[model samples]
Target: MRATLIEVAPRDGFQPIGPFIPTDDKVSFVEAAHAAGLRRIEIGSFVNPAAVPQLRDTAEVLRRTAHLEGLDAQVLVPNARGVALALEAGAQHLAYVVSASEAHNRSNVRRDVATSIRDYGEIVAGLPAGLRLRLNLATSFDCPFDGRMEEDLVLSRLDALLAHREDVEVGLCDTTGRADPDHVFSLAAKCLARFGARTRWVFHGHDTYGLGLANVAAAWRAGITGFDAAFGGLGGCPFAPGATGNVATEDVAWMFRRMGVETGVDLDALLRLATRAAALPGASPGGRVRAALADRCAAA
Candidate 1:
């Protein structure tokens, strides 16, 4: 089966860079990705401007592109207030993050896992009709504060998220890049067994330990076809100390292209985007394929 890829460079990948992505360029990036065959993308986050200055113009950006066709523009909302902001901007798809480890959850969202889940439920309940919700269980594999996390804790959290709303899609986060193939297989098998066909699973993995691709392979074998990837491998977990960047969009696309699995993304275009993005004030992309792409571009 073909994998469904969500390009998150404009949001998850770009927000972590030193300087904020210019509003115009942010829109351009979104447009470029769409033109390159990425139908789904996380456009921005709706959080406190002080917390994530890069996403401060999320509303403005969304307002301008609200009429774009053939794109599922997603926004990340950290709380009910953020959800309200996203809804105000007409975001059709919303993503909420909750860490599986209690320490990470408290540090990241200032709430325990249970409270965060409850808050997400409240957020979803109040959204307008036709809006979709996706909950990303961050730190599902391990935590910086508490070290390795057990599969049971992650499963329990998934159960809570699924129980809250049957329509909610879930992404298992390998925050801190602590996941291996075995870990992915075990957690995914449990998720598939528990949620069965009711749940749609997406993998949100980090490349901290260089196991991102292996974990992706494991998830694919476990029946997951959707994944969250950052352009140029841009992004880091703010809550997890020493956590590395996310799985690179170009690297994963390159792998998929070579394997004959359709990701519906142009690897060459993605590398161009990554190379340019990496030139930004503090944007250092983590994709291994960027150097080669840069050389090719230079030669041309």
Candidate 2:
């Protein structure tokens, strides 16, 4: 079987890191990951620099690496202003994030879910043609403030968002990393059944409780092919309390490889990049395969 692994280490992984990664280094990481066979990569986000100081140079990074052939080069946008900044920087693919849990949404964006969805509708109205779109539904499975999210609530939120645009890729985020495989499978199944043919789907998971890969497998079984994983497992939600890094890209690739799935990612090259990510100043890296396979990859 075939699957897609969207590398988010640069955008999602680097956001919460305390030290500012040099612009040239960021560009190099994107380029290296592309060379390692990752066609789609979230370069960075178009948000307030004060909020996420590490990615302040996202536009520069995007511009520096935009020449990579066939690279999706995704940038995340939170509102209309972010959409403007991204488009101004010539971003072709934009991932817009909105929380499904109302309380978490308020805490993260200082607005209610209704207001965010309304903003998305307006964003869609003014968006230029030929620009690719993705919606990251944060806290779709669990929230630090509200606990486990209701499946119906998630579905309803999807219904509302898809109303504005159906030609989008939707990512269900386990923002708190408290989701079990059962919940992950059930909600993903529901989303696939309800909106499978309407829009593209992706699963963004975390390893806080060590269920990240298990949840990924569950989602994959439910027919979700695209997934978001950070190399070196370097990520967490600044707003979501107690959340940890994303499911490791190397770990996910390892699992799929053992199962005879094609990810188009070179694991040895990924291990090398992941080592660099782990060595970054102030980096709190997580993931199983990188540590276990280090000697093996080195000798190979």
Candidate 3:
């Protein structure tokens, strides 16, 4: 199966930083990812500017990249209001996140799980035809506030989301980076068994515990082909305590390529981009491949 890695560096990677990344720099990051052969990217989020000042110019970022051919620009929308703004900005793909843990959901979006589900339903219902939507089940593995979430609870939340819109893609998120290989494989197998042909499944993992690649491999073995990653491994959940950077895009691409999987990404170019990303203010590079590349350079 062809593996697809969705770049989230422009959005998730930059969201937790204190200083706002320049709008042009954000655009350049997207362009660099595209140049590295990534087709899909989450450029920014459409939420209250006061809440995440870093992504305040999401619309402008979208406008600047509107002419990029064959590139799918995705944006995170917190609710119906974000959905409206995303549509106004001519976004074709929108992602909504809701944690499985009630406490985490409330903390992340200031709404309870049920309310977030209802809001997602409203947003899904109002979406125009042909617009792609993805639901990120945050804390599917474990929650910082509530501890490890049960598989049944995650499935139940997924059922609620499917009930709202059966076609919306689902991404299992390890919000606090607490997922292990066995747990990831087990839950992914169950999810695939439940929703295999009905909807697409993507895995979103963090490397805080240093198991991001292992978890990704586990998910792949469980039949997941789509993944969400950030360049230089830069990202953390502002609301979810102890959460850290996401699985790095170059790291994932390198793994898949070495495994004889088709990722359609240029590893050398992606490593170069990772180097550039690491130089960004407050950026932290978290992928092993980058260090390996640095060593190779030093040896050369």
TM-score for all predictions?
0.95, 0.98, 0.97
Ranking by TM-score: 2, 3, 1
Candidate 3, 3: how far from true, in Å?
0.6
Q: Which stretches of candidate 2 lie over 4 Å from their true place?
A: 297-300
134 in model 1: Cα distance from truth in Å? 0.7
Where model 3 places Cα greater than 4 Å from the true spot, the runs are 295-300
Q: Top model by TM-score, which number? A: 2
Question: What are the lDDT scores of the predictions, listed in order?
Answer: 0.83, 0.92, 0.90
Tens-digit lDDT track for model 1 on 1-300?
Answer: 599998887887776777767899988888777876888889899988887788899888787776668888889988888887888777889999998999998988888888998987787677788878888888888899898889887887877877778667789988889889998988888888888887789998889889888888899888889988887788886668888788988888888888889998877777777776666778866878887666643311
Rank the models by lDDT, top first: 2, 3, 1
lDDT tens readout by residue for model 2, 157-262: 9999999998789999999889999999999999888986879899999999999999999999999999999989999988998888999999999999998999
Off by over 4 Å in 1: 295-300
Cα RMSD of predicted structure 2: 1.2
Local distance difference test, candidate 1: 0.83
RMSD in Å for candidate 1, one decimal? 1.6
Cα error, candidate 2, residue 186 (Å): 0.5
